[model samples]
Target: QRQAMANNSRPTPTMAPNNSLRWERCSMDIDHLSLHCRQHSHTVLTEATPVPQWIDDRVSLTQVLEAMQASPMHVLDTEFERVRTFWPKLALVQVALPARNVLIDPLAFADLGDLGRVLGNGRPWLMHSASEDLVALKPLTEHAPTALFDTQIAAALLGLGSSLAYQKLVQSELGVSLAKSETRSDWLQRPLSAEQIDYAADDVIHLQALCDRLGDRLDRLGRMDWLWQDGQRQIAAGYELLPSANPHHEFRAAYKLPLAAQVRLVAVLEWRERTARSTDRPRSWVLDNATAIDIAQNPPRSGPELLGKLANCRAFPRRQVGEVIDLLASAEAGAPFQPAPAPLDRETENALRQAREQIDALAAALALESSTLCSRRLLEARARLGTWPPDCTRWRQQLLEPLVQATLGASSPTQNP
Candidate 1:
């Protein structure tokens, strides 16, 4: 009986009219939400949604390409895995156009270049948080957002929240709560659960509504350009070395300057990045910041030299030390490509902090998780870029950056907030 209750204790009317699943009577209160999560934690995992027969192998790449080619650019999201692996396994793909919705089964047909075109050269898309989705798509295609608008960016612009999840954004924006049951499901599973499929599709279902609300808010405030800037920033951040780009490419070239310091900063960061790749671990795990900086400051040309002063050397194999030295030498010999520099200004910095507060407060007012919508780092990057947040990063621009810009005189006031 207890087991049955546990299994059956899910949201009633298990599926929504839109075929998406939702949680029942979820509390909006922060404490209550946390308590409820800790209690019935099984469901609150990941976007484990259902996969309809239409999305099977029969769902040809031709059909997808035809749709993508015909439709105005669309908003997309994806889920993947990166646990002790060289490549992040593609899990699910959520595509949201103005009038239609799609949930692609990556296990069925992973590649989408013939279908999905990214890179800021196409129609605008309304992605939520683009970083994860972008990284996941790297193994599949060179999908850089052509034209982008992150809903999370928009939410920030509206001062709704810093960073919010699609579910939380939907609830706050449309008063519709989503289920958390599949928040951590094994997305690679073949026969996905009915509940899981619903959860996955739900990630992009309300994106159109999200875009409508955020677009209007951005326009009303005359901060549409903020959307473009956010998109560009996301693209700059979204660039991931192809699985083959350099197995050891630091997850990105982020530790270049202000983030890292010195002339050999890029070389040191790249060395650590390649080391992480060869080991198939995160850059942070391979070499912590302080040690990386120290080693970078004084490069070791020989394996013995590298293993000499480094503290984490013991953590790695001695044989790997030689390879590490080689990589370090190579990096030192060549320069890493730097993305357009992120500018710094006192006003934008202050704006970033104030917008973070404003967005957090607004999220509380709407009963949403601020982190799900936007983040301080993303906001800071946006401000530094001195551009409007785009819409393609899963409403991130709407929910956070616009409001931040409004405070910074980077954007005008909107009617919504």
Candidate 2:
């Protein structure tokens, strides 16, 4: 199926006369069309929107790479489908260069390692909400970019807003209204619709302009390093392949389980994680959280009983019931289970409150969002452990350490009445 698509091609657009700009239609196939432009001078296309070029062939991809090499930075975005899979399936990649915009079809090429290398070659990538895109690109690019500028994070740091949607940010920052009708369209289908192509093109088209305006604000605020720090953190998290070590902790009710049941829960969760990755299915499909918790709370005596418990779980393998029974038995007989940490005690709760107040004051002084500085979960962990959260960035820690220390000190048993 893919070979037929790869074999398809159309003639390249002719260049315009010197010192003149011209828009030419370039077709990748009968159903897929792209627009290319030829210009004498290199300038960022902010005022006039350009149609995205369709690059499905090696020659076209190479030409795009050459154009990218001459530029210091590029704006990037991706469209993917992850509804039924453990990993994101890359459908399309949109890139905005100084001269042109192009959409590369991942389904047409057997290998994209070359494109990945070029993208991760240390040149800055300007993206909005880059976490998922980074993960989607991992199969093609093994290494993350050395430098990244996430416009969403940059805006949040500047007190603009937190978790702002791409369209909203573009509208607010650049006064550009982008259509969102094709957001839920299926990208994996062959011969993507013209609306889908246009929507994909718009995703990265104005990213450079938005980045320029937000970046200047960040530079003036002296928070560009902070944005970079957070960007790197996002990259690290996105590329993480392993499931969380403490998967059970993700459930709010896991803390209520007895020590042995909690141990069983952890084992089951880890098994589910491994199974999901190996089978390329979602974790919930292998074993729903509620079902896992139920099984852990009430250990089935035999495979029949386990099967009965999983009657409602359509995706769980019926043949694995015996295996799961054995796993539960082993967990029950394993070494003494470490009791999960109890909920925050009164003193610690007070400390968390104090720490939050301090953070609010600090944020106000810095003119930054409090959540951007520290999340409540991180604060609770800090107050409970009397140490900085491991994920806390250096810049944030430097600004927040004194407040954390003061809060903990004030709540110490010796100091408290």
Candidate with the greatest TM-score versus the true structure: 2
Whole-model lDDT values for every prediction: 0.56, 0.74
Which runs in model 2 stand beyond 4 Å of their true positions?
Answer: 1-46, 332-338, 410-417
Tens digit of lDDT per residue, candidate 1, span 1-417?
Answer: 123223433331112223322112223232111101111122122232223222445445456556666555465777777764545778777775433455677677545554545323354556888876666775555546455678887787676766667778887877668889898788787666667666666777666556656666666665555555656656656664533322222334333534323435555555556666777676656666666666655667777777776665333556677776665555533355443253456765676678788888877775556764555555654565455433225334455545665675564322220
Per-residue lDDT for 339-403 in model 2, tens only?
Answer: 45668889878878888998999999988789988998777766765666556766877777778
- How far is 306's C-alpha from truth in model 1 (Å)? 6.5
Q: What is the C-alpha RMSD of each candidate to the true structure, in Å?
A: 11.9, 9.3
